[model samples]
Structures are given as structure tokens and as C-alpha cells.
Target: MALKETRRPSIFWLMAWVCFGLLGGSVKFRVAHPERIPERGAFVIAPNHYSEIDPVIVGMMLYRLGRIPRFLTKASLFKIPVVGWFLRRSGQVPVERAGSAAAKGPSPLAAAREIARAERIVVVYPEGTLTRDPDMWPMRGKNGAARIALEQGIPVIPVAHWGTQALMGRYAKKINLLRRHPIDFAIGKPVDLSEFEGKPIDQHLLADATEKIMGAITAELEKLRGDKAPAHRWDPSLHGQSETGRIEP
Candidate 1:
């Protein structure tokens, strides 16, 4: 028999915000530049994916900042136990990374296109998974965000989040109430991808663009956390430090 899918229901956002509020995770957001995004249209909020709870933290921040977003999550996450139910109830979109060719399910790109033509927002984590880096530095991301941004003429807003990893760990599992750390988010001005609208999304171009976005996000995180910039080649193994140390910024 085919496996059933899990998703987040529309009310998930409401419940998630309440849960976080009760848990004491502070939510702060600032939109320094709104011109980056169009006055009123579909746009992409591309952020670095660092922990499991990142969606909730970032999603709530977006909502509080006056934008309701449709988040793209992993298909496998929708098959979990109770969590799966909550995801579906929250109206989250589940994406199949593998066997995606079988059928065109609700892809992030599709959601982005819809956002471009609709009134809602789409939250896409370019980095498909949590960062393996101990410092939580963003790894190389996929081309999904770039493709949607260029193809649909939508603005790309880069969001940076910090502190959620402490509550959920690098690889999110159960809640870490013991840590009880505070989290913060910073939203950068939207980026215009019209220059590459029609050009092929080559690896070099995509990588460069993704790197630029990640860099901006990391910088914001650093500013918020009062941390120094990480070395361009920040390999913990080379320095004999644990991967967790590099995760802060």
C-alpha cells in the first residue's frame, strides 16, 4: 500500500505561535528595508535551515512581521508519529526529495509560483536540511529558491535566525528545555533576480547566488548574536574544535 502523506494544517501556525509563546522563546523581527520586496505581490523568504524548530521560529517571525507564509517541509517528516499530525494540521507542504519524478507533488517551486501570483508568502529553506556544521553555518544550498525567484519575477527576502538550534540541537530531536535559550531573527531586504531571469541556472551562478544570500544571512545572525565573522574556510576538523563550536554564528 502507498504511504500516506503528512502536512501542516492552516491552524498549525496559530498553535505553533502559542506554543512558542508559552515556552518563552522570544520573537523579535525588524524590517529595515521594505523596498526590496514589491508593494504587494508574491515573494520568497529564503532562510538558512539550521534546526528542526527553525520553521516555527522563522515562520512566526514572518507572520508577526505582517506576512503569512507557506513553508516547504520534507515528505518524510509528515509520516512521523504525533508530530506528523501537527505538521499536517499546520498546513505545511511536504516535498518528496527522492522519487520526485514519480509525480509532481506540491513542490517548493510550485508554491513559490503560487505565491508570486497570489497574496500569500512562501518560506523556502534553500539548504535542504539542517546544517551539519557544528557552528550552524549554512552549507551550500540547492537551486530551488533561485529558480523560482528568477522565473516568476518574485523578490527574494533573506532571513537569518539564531538560537533555535540550542533548543533543538544541530539535528533536532526532542525538545531541549534544559537549554531554554533565547532566539532572534533578522530579515534583510529582498533581492532582485531579474538580471538572471531568463538565463540558465548554472551551478556556478546558482552557487554564487546562494552563497551571497547565505553570507547576508550569516552576517545578520552575527550582528544579532554579537559574534565575529567566521573564517571563509571554517573547518572545525582543521582547528581541532567540535563542530558544535562553529554553530553559534
Candidate 2:
């Protein structure tokens, strides 16, 4: 007989979100504005990739809040001996990092579709890889998240995270909760790309939208952390215009 699967129970997700929100009280978590997204519907929770544990923490937050989020995880991870079993049972999608097949794999897309059909939330790390943002900011990303949003007609909510760097730098592979860092998460309003409707949904548009959303996230993050990001083109002081003015289709 096949081995039994280890799925993430609804109760577990609910409890996880609640526990995290409550736990966040001890730390310093600001929801920013929770009214941005509807409580129910198919939406994308796109957060920057910082710590490997970021996904779990964000997932726990949503789960505790009574929302189920599907994550796009690396395919290689599924090859691991026993851990892969747990991932599959938990309904996580394994993503190949290499070729076209990896980008548009049928199985993962199907899983994404199913999650949307269920009217649940999905978490995605758009950066494709951990940040190379010298400043630990989000790097340019692959637009799989945007494509998913367009195809499914779901809103993409940008989520910015801070304090994780203090918890664990880019080089650190584990969490140090005992350090009691003030982890920050700011969720931007749902981005509506309906204007792109009927047009060919190409990577260019998808990538552009993803960048815009991430940019919004970063701006919010900067405000919360009271830090200054590098003066890139997005920096208004250098351009005399807001980064939002530079978004491309």
C-alpha cells in the first residue's frame, strides 16, 4: 500500500495564522492596512525572498488568519528523500528552475488553478531566488506570479518583509527567534491589472507588473524600517519623480 500523506490540515493553517498574529504582538508586526484586500477570493500574496523561513512565517500568518496560501517551491526540494513527501501532502507546488517546462509546468499550474478555484490565497516568492539586492532588497523577478494573476483574474498583493535580515542575513540558513528581532511585514493593497485584459499576457507585462508591486512593497518597507534604500533610478530624489511613474506595461 502507498504510504499515508501528511497534509496541512485546515485547522493547522487557521491555528498557525492566529498564533503568528498573536506572536507578532510580542514582536512588532504592523498590518499597515488590512482593508486592502477582500477577506475572500483568489489572490496572490507576493512577498520578497529573504530568509528561507520567510515563507513559513508568512504562511503561518495567513493560515492563522483563516486563509490557505499555496506556495511555489523549488522542484529539487521534492527530490529529497522524506521531506518531499511532506511537501506534496501539504499541497505545495514544486517549481523547476531550469527550462520552459519548469516555467509552465502543467502539474504546478494545475495546483495553482485548484487553489484559485477554491477561492483561497497563494503565496509566491517572485524574485525566483534569494535577494542579490546588495542592500538585501528584492531583485528583478520572473513574472510567474503576474502571469498566474492574469490567467486566474486574481489580484496580486505585494508583501514586504523586514527584520528578517536581522534574524538571519542572506548568508544565514536558519532562524534565531531567541534574538527577538522586530520582524516587520507590510501588505500593500491588491494590484488590479484588469487594464491588461484582452492583451497578450507576455513576460514583459507580467514582469513589469511584478516590479511595480514589489516597488510599492519596498517603499512601504522603507517607511516602516526608517531606512534609506540605495539611490537607484526608482529613487525620486535622483529622478524628481516617484518610482510609480516609471512602471512599464
Candidate 3:
């Protein structure tokens, strides 16, 4: 069941559909639990981050699930000339790498507000960037996704995926198309935030909600990888690693 018309322009919708479609054909996708995607209304699709190509892979998966996905991408990526122009025009939201709305929008509340206004499936990386874990397991999450869902009264859908790293390794500059990498995606039920409902939206509440979202994603990932995640989630601060860049230990 495809979603109703997207808020993005027809041209961009077609462009992204074609671009990601070609990329999608290059890789073999094994998806589980596609039914978890919401058929109606606006919702957040939170996924684990591991590779540079994840956005393309996840966007294609969501589109196939019948929702045209809009991403919460870093502001810096939106500054790269033609790429930036396309990002802005394609209806993607520009967010500060520091985890706030971009300066152009100028309000902490502005990004989520615009996303809610669009009423489309918005993909937010709870970690805010590629995973810093040595094993590429999910690390501690940023509160952006939770903030959007809680403030906008929308649900956050957790998704776990694997094999993008094989298609293009973490921090790799080139995608290997010589062989078809089998990528897997598993969508989980929307995180239950009923307990946090009506609470003061503070750092603590947002962190807790973000963990809930991450946990849901990790759980689905375990199904694909057939193993358990580490008992402790990787903490960038504890490891003295930068949150937004490649940090070599």
C-alpha cells in the first residue's frame, strides 16, 4: 500500500525515485517485517547508521514500502553547491550537526515543526551520524528523533539494517558495485512513549525516549544478525571520539 501523495515536488520525487531505484537494483535487498511501516499519518523512521550509503539504501526501502522518505541531513552537506541546492529543493530538512535546527531556520523548534507540517515519513538517525562503535553496533543516541516525535506528537518507527557496510564500508569513498551485496532491513513497531507522555520535555526525558528508539532498532537488528548487541552502548564522549567525523583510534 503506497502512501498518499508526498509533499515534495513532483520533479524531486521522480528524481530521487529514479536515482535510488538504480542504486537499489545494484544491491540485493532482503527485507523483513515491512508491515511495521505506518500506512497513514506522519511518523518518524529511525534507523541505525553505519555507512555513507545508508541514506540511499534506507530511502529506497522506505519508498518501496510505499512512503516517500524525507531525511534530516546535516547542514554541512546542504552547503555543497549543487548538492546543497538539490537537498533544499527536494524537501529534506537541514539540521545542525550539533543536533539543532539549521541556522537558516533559526529556531530549535523550527525543524521538527516543518517536518510535522509535511506529514511524510521523516528518517532521523538517533545517533546523529555514523556509528562510532568499533564493531559498528549502535552507539548512544542523540535526542533529535525523540524530540521531533514528542514535540510533534508523532510516533517514532525503529528500523535496523545490515549490509550497507558491505556495499560501501564505513567511511569508504566508493561503493562496490562489482558484486551484489545482500542488504537486510527489519522494521519494528513504533516505540511506545506513552509513559513519557505529558512529562516536561527535558534532556532526561528526551534521552530516555531516544534510548527506547535505539533499543527497538537494535532489537530488530539482532534478528538480522542473529546475535546480541553489546551490553553497553558505545559512548563517543567516553571514547574521546568526535561525534560527526571519522575518528581513528
Candidate 4:
């Protein structure tokens, strides 16, 4: 089934203008294989997390591809004044992480269902947060995206991007606008989860699905950067690093 092309909400336009004002002239953005995104379907847009500005770059890429991005954002951000209002008006979903007081409300999967019902694109950072990998490679991912894909029978489209980290450091507060940064976005084909579909959703199945999704994302990144990824992905728990953000050495 195809999703109808609807006009973007006012908030989206406002954000677009903001992104343009911030990134338009300073960043040279490039998107490869954007056609990989389904023209009309409810699909999970799983992308590798690299920098704080990654969402803006990825969102702009999708906007260029003619799709309004619906992100699965952290719930706490919904409490802020202007940002919260914009998020709600823009149709972004709030996801309550474990241990957060906001976790008492609806599950993220419920938000996924709402996105699917609307047959819109929902951008999910499968790594949950930014990559803790020392080399900026994609690390172990959480299972929310995989569960939603398997449960809803939707495609998990993997996307990879580079250069956002260069423009803004992982945890840096300043944006470097002196030089034009080249941001490259590559979209891979939909992950094949046919074998796991219709089966009981479990840890093992979710793990396997996540591996495939992350692997696909890494491969696309390799193509964009012309480099090979490490043999094994980094796991924060094993390295004794917090999973929320960058790991400080």
C-alpha cells in the first residue's frame, strides 16, 4: 500500500528554515541512493548514530527526498518549553528510556504503532544513542527498531552518514562554520527479515535482526568512506562505558 503525500506541518517548515539557516550555506550535503527509501510505505528508518548534529543532517536528507521525518525522540526533551511544543506539533514521538520518570506512560512501541498507522517515516537511531566506538563505527544496537519491524511487518531501511562529527564534535557545544563540511548520506536497501517475521519475538530473534540492520548500515558507511569496518562491533557494557552518550577514555 502507498501512503498519500500530505503537506508538511507548519512546524516542519519552521524546522526546515532553522536547519537551512544553520547548515545550508556552511555544509555541503550529499545524499546517495535516496530512492532506496520507499516512495510510500510505513518503514523504520534505522541510521547509524555518530554526532549530535546527525539528526539534522539525516532529517534534511529525508526532506530532500520528499518525506516528512517523524523521529523517535527522548521523552525528557518533551518537557522543555519551545522545543517541546515544536516536537508535539511536528508529530515527533517521545520515547521514555528505562529509569526515566516519564517511562510510566505509553511504550515506544505504541508510538511506532501510531507511525505505522499513519504510514509515515519514523527515524530511529538503532544504536539508541551515539556510537561509543572509539573509531566512530556503529556499536551494538537496542532492540526497539527490530521489534517494531518484526511486529509490524515493515521494512527497516538502513542509512549511513559521514562528516557530521567533523562539523560538530560528539559532545562539543560549538559548531564549526568556518569551513564548509561535506556531509554524505547513503541509504541501503531494506533489511531482509522474512525468516524472522511471523515468529515469536524473543531476545535471540531481536538480536539477530539488529545485527543485520547494523551490519547493513556499516556496509553503506564503508562505501561512502571507502574503508572497511572493524571485524567486531563495540559493546559499551563490555567496555564499562555509559550507553547514553560518547565513552570518555
Native-vs-model 4 lDDT? 0.85
Residue by residue across 142-246, what tens digits does model 1's lDDT show?
677777777676677887777776667665458776545767666677664555667787877776676666776677767767886567724445655443323
**Model 2 Cα lDDT, one tens digit per residue, 151-247:** 9888888888777666556656565656466766777877767777678988777777777766766776787678876655232335343322222
For candidate 1, the per-residue lDDT at 246 reads 33
Which prediction has more favorable lDDT, 1 or 2? Answer: 2
Off by over 4 Å in 2: 1-28, 99-110, 231-249
lDDT at 181, model 2? 64
Q: Of models 2 and 4, which has the larger lDDT?
A: 4
Q: What lDDT score is found at residue 222 in candidate 2?
A: 81
Query: Candidate 2 — what's its lDDT?
Result: 0.65
Q: What's the residue-level lDDT of 241 in candidate 3? A: 85
Question: Which candidate number would show the highest lDDT if scored against the true structure?
Answer: 4
Clashes of each: 18, 3, 0, 0
Give candidate 1's error at residue 42 in angstroms.
1.4
Model 3, residue pairs in steric clash: none
Give the per-residue Cα lDDT of candidate 2 at 77.
83
Clashing pairs in 2: 17-63, 17-64, 18-64
Candidate 4 structure quality by residue, lDDT tens digits, 96-167 = 767756558667788887898788888888898889888889999999889988888889999999998878
Candidate topping TM-score: 4
- Estimated TM-score per prediction? 0.73, 0.75, 0.90, 0.94
- Where's the lowest-lDDT run of ten residues in candidate 2? 1-10
- Specify the poorest-scoring 10-residue window by lDDT in model 3: 99-108
State each model's CA lDDT, in order. Answer: 0.64, 0.65, 0.82, 0.85
